[model samples]
Target: MKGVIRTILLIALICIFSIQFTMSMVIFTDLDNHWGKEHVNWAANTMELIDGFNDGTFRPDDIMTRIDFILALNTLLVKKNIYQDVGLHFGKGINISYTDVDRYHWAYGELAILATYISEYGNADIEIKEIFTEDTFNPNKPINRHEVLLLSRAVTTPPIEDHIISFKDVDANIPNYNLIIESVNNGILRGYSDGTLRLDKNITRAEAATVLRRVATDVNYLADKFLVYEDIKSRNIGIELPIFQQIDEHESQSQLHQRFIDAITSIQYSAFVGHIPYHERHLYDMQPIETLWGLKNQNYYNVIGNNYYLIKYDKDLVMERKKELVKEGLQHLKLNVNSSFDGLISFLSIAAELLPMEETMNAAEATFRQSDNSKTKLETGLFIMSQYMANNEMDKGLNIHRSLLEYEFADDIKAQIIRNYGYLLYSLKGADEAIRILKDLKDEMDLDFNELNPNAIEFTFNGLMKQILIQSKN
Candidate 1:
């Protein structure tokens, strides 16, 4: 009878263990499904710099310091080689800039400098010791959901092609306000339905975990990894193992803080992809030109010498149709224009073809003068002349080109300009002067005409000079 009792007791213990294991597995699975899906998507799509997500949980609502945001931005920038260094600098001693934040205070000195984001207000110098007021940076305080959205938007670049997030409540005029709205609009963040941004509220540990997880999954930096934990089996082990691992890695408070730092840096680096709009030709071809017509309605005029021209479209409807044709031509030109010069020339040519000749010339002249440097300004002037010449306005084009020749620029650039000017003279009724200029250019300058575009520099000594000679004989 005693042996029989022992067997029954052993069986009962096994059953209890199995029941606990099953219950834990269920909880783990639920948490994993609930948090992991969104977290993975966010990390993969929004933040791609973070790796090893399966090994950690990100606690989002935890108070974030000024150092945290900076470090994160630095990390993202570093990955893209946008900045040369990563980390912070602090003034020595217990000399925190403000009474509330002392040098020895954790993150005080760092936060003090990072507070420049708020201090950008019309020369208002930020004081560190100042308790973080509403619409200000508070290093010691917890970061709220609204603030998180703001941070996300500030660090990322513009032209975020993502779905917009809608928040029931968020004023557009607060500090870092538009960023918060943009973040939500881009689906990088979300808020409660109560229509409150809750900017001053502290974030909870679990909430932070959820946020971090979302960041990880969206970036695709840490989706595949081994997760291990004791008692994990009891919590629906396999399904929730990843989150447990993350939390376990941050078992100590300091570790948790460091992990947060690392995670933020990763998010910034991999979130945004910047590229020129014209690089993708096939994609641009499919997009309707009407979408870009609104750009033409923004008027710009230029007054050069004795002529005034309007670059702005007078009629919105006609401007829209013209824009569509120009866009189509641009798409076609992109196929043949392999060099940057060719691309630029093609773009200008297309613009000239679509807009009025006077408008194109005025726009080009205005663009040239506004350039901060001489080289770009000279190039713009040359492009304007080139367009004018194409439009049979030789006198106007020659006058602009003459102005360009007077500018002090590099030897090669000057040579090109002289060659074009000489060609322009030949095109008019000044064959003798054109021949003299071309002969002087060939004799004085050591240049490889072959290295330049044959079509672009068609007025060069070898090309245009020969044509002029043949025409003069005829």
Candidate 2:
């Protein structure tokens, strides 16, 4: 009897352990159609980057937001021990703030730090503020397909150039075409069974997990790209150097306006002017209906530069379509610049840069004067200035610069505005006047020459100053 009782107790113990193990394990019920079931499960179980709902469902089709994506990226960063050596406050010291992302946001710290850290790695010294609306992160916005490719491409070195995209929807001319192709080659991105890359589609949770997995394990991933930031963190490695420093305490409003213009110009120039082989051939193939659709939907113009691409193919056709949209948009702006801010901004930017329509520039300038918000004023003024520059109206552009100089602005903005003024002077008056203006302005701003380098925005201003000074001597 004693032997039988002991055996029963052992059996019960084994059963109890089994129950606990089964309860702890995650099992998804709705992965029948998931293209990346194995990958999602591995990431979910191993990395814990992806999670399931209360009902034990992965909800793979659900959209992933910018905040969530940033969180996952932070997880990867943590796993790689990227921040372990860096100080506890690596990103906290940066004067980076996002209007839409408050302290209450769950991923605020991660998003803030990653934004700063990624900016350090890019070919373009992209400040976090340049990507958003007046220092807003728009954190809750869904991460779209193209953004995934673009972000990955920005950070990782592609294996090789692959112009071929298996998806039927992706044309070779779009801005993200090569990025998508490279991502596919690296096994980081995929297309649907319907043979669509769905470049504008909002990314799903499953897709995000798969991509993150690829970013971590793919042979194409480059760890050396992060050496600069790593070296910065290691104070004992060599002569310690400050990567960036703030300008003077006080800045004029005119200067801030110029900074805004430079930011906008950089964005448009990068988008429309960058070279991608085989893009021109695909540009001619873009259908009129597609252009119309893109204009109506505002379909991630950064991804394809579709409006510009269409214009390049047939300028009159693109402009005619834009006129209709611009008319409606201008009417909305006339209603209230504050109310139709997005539409007005988008319209003005497109019109100023790609189309350079006289009517649009006038409306943008008028809207700037009517607006009370400094952000709006800065944005609209930038659009107007960009339009003038595009139209070769340098004198008119100088007038805009001169008018903004009277307004008080933040220090950073003021520095940029003065830089613009100096450049304009160089363009219209000659190198001597421009050099004098820049020298006086530099002294007034108290710029730290030691902290400035070719990678700095101040470097651009200073470089222009040096070029003018040299030209004057010659």
Candidate 3:
């Protein structure tokens, strides 16, 4: 029973992130080649920030209206869990009223919540001057590119310093020059290829999505997505420790629940049991749960039944399993390398890519450069490319990656490089090119992309390639 429960939770987390990686982000037929497609898909799927019309087409090219912007912005804030008590009731009751948006309107609650949220929590920099004029909000008007940035500045964290903005058309004299520049600097707004800011052009749905995702998601959340499936199977290392607790007659429900919570808290979701064994590392999918019910729901453990189990992973099994996988990877590549060092480098490179704010990358790079070996250099380049992609220097990263492909190495390394390159092409180069590259390898290798369970995803090569081959039916 305990094994059954552990298996269930592992499968679910894998399916979610695996498909997210492999498949197309959106179903809107119009989004096939749209430059902003990735943003649109992320906003629609990850944030639940927007949806297509009843006809099934996203109409992504259409100009985003004022009302549409408000609804999406309000959704982003709520989904991000930044604001509390932001519905029709704000703990102080419905405190504000809009002249144009009345109680009868369908989105009245959404509009009201956003307006009140901004007014209550917004800084002096983000005044509602653009929307509210003469006691009436022009909700139907097309939202300008700059207007969205001004409103977003109210909710988002500031862009990192030293970010380049090359909007040749945006002169300093323009009223919202700073806001427009900030948008570009934040990686939200990109001017056309001709170098014109087109400040006054009506923002499209795709463009609006690009603006919203950058404003909503921070570095930590995005990085966590990478580490979610690090287990040998699905990347979740948690397992069930069966605790058989009989139902007490005299004890109240609250009392019994507290006991369960205490038992759960005692089992730590930590990195490792002891010191680094052979320098093998393990990453567990750690979800923080405060209440007993929260713990039960997340782990799929049954507190209601007579038998219960606390969830914890076996560290020895976790790391050893990873070591076995790394060996297989080395064999497939037909390369004679130290399994421990190669695996360590793989994990280190990922850490550098995901947690860029940490000092870990510099140490990892030093080790890479010192080795002066082909494997070290290749993985090190993977790390550097990821950082460059993160910083919006895609062209430079792409060019460097192309050169890495020319490096002579094992079949495994070549496959690794090809897949990694295809992965970039998946996001920046579009799905078709990515699929073609991967399919060729799949055909040549005669590989099976299936995982441990038909429904779940494994971190193995086959599981990863599924993401590109499968398009969204949405």
Residue 184 displacement in candidate 3 (angstroms): 2.7
* Candidate 1 vs candidate 3, TM-score winner: 3
Q: Give the Cα lDDT of each candidate.
A: 0.42, 0.57, 0.52
Judge candidate 1 at residue 126 and give its lDDT: 26
**Positional deviation of 362 in candidate 3, in angstroms?**
30
Q: What digit string (tens of lDDT, one per residue) describes model 2 on residues 1-474?
A: 999999999999999999987776678898876797877776787778867888989888889987787787767766765545344333463445876667666667776676656565432234445434356777788988777776664444443224465678877776546556776765567677898878778898888887887666531123222111010111211111111111223234334333333433333444565632364534332244344344436432121123333333344574576555546546556555543132234445555554446677677878777876454455566667766776778788777666665566564564456566666788788866766666675566555654212223354455555445434544
Model 3 misses residue 240 by how many Å? 18
TM-score of each: 0.29, 0.39, 0.40
Task: Tell me each candidate's RMSD, in Å, in order.
Answer: 30.6, 28.9, 20.4
Evaluation by TM-score, superior candidate among 2 and 3: 3
The candidate maximizing lDDT is 2
- Encode model 1's per-residue lDDT on 1-474: one tens digit a residue: 999999999999999999986653322222354534444333333444322224354433234444444444434443433222223234422333555545666666445444543233111122323324445345545556655555544333221233454444555555655555655653445566676556556554344434444332222211111111011011111221111112222244444333333332332222233322455433332222221222223211101100101112123346665565454443433332221121233345547777676755565566555544444345456566555655778777667666765566555455456555655677675666776766665555544543212223222344444445435644
Error of 3 at 365 (Å): 28
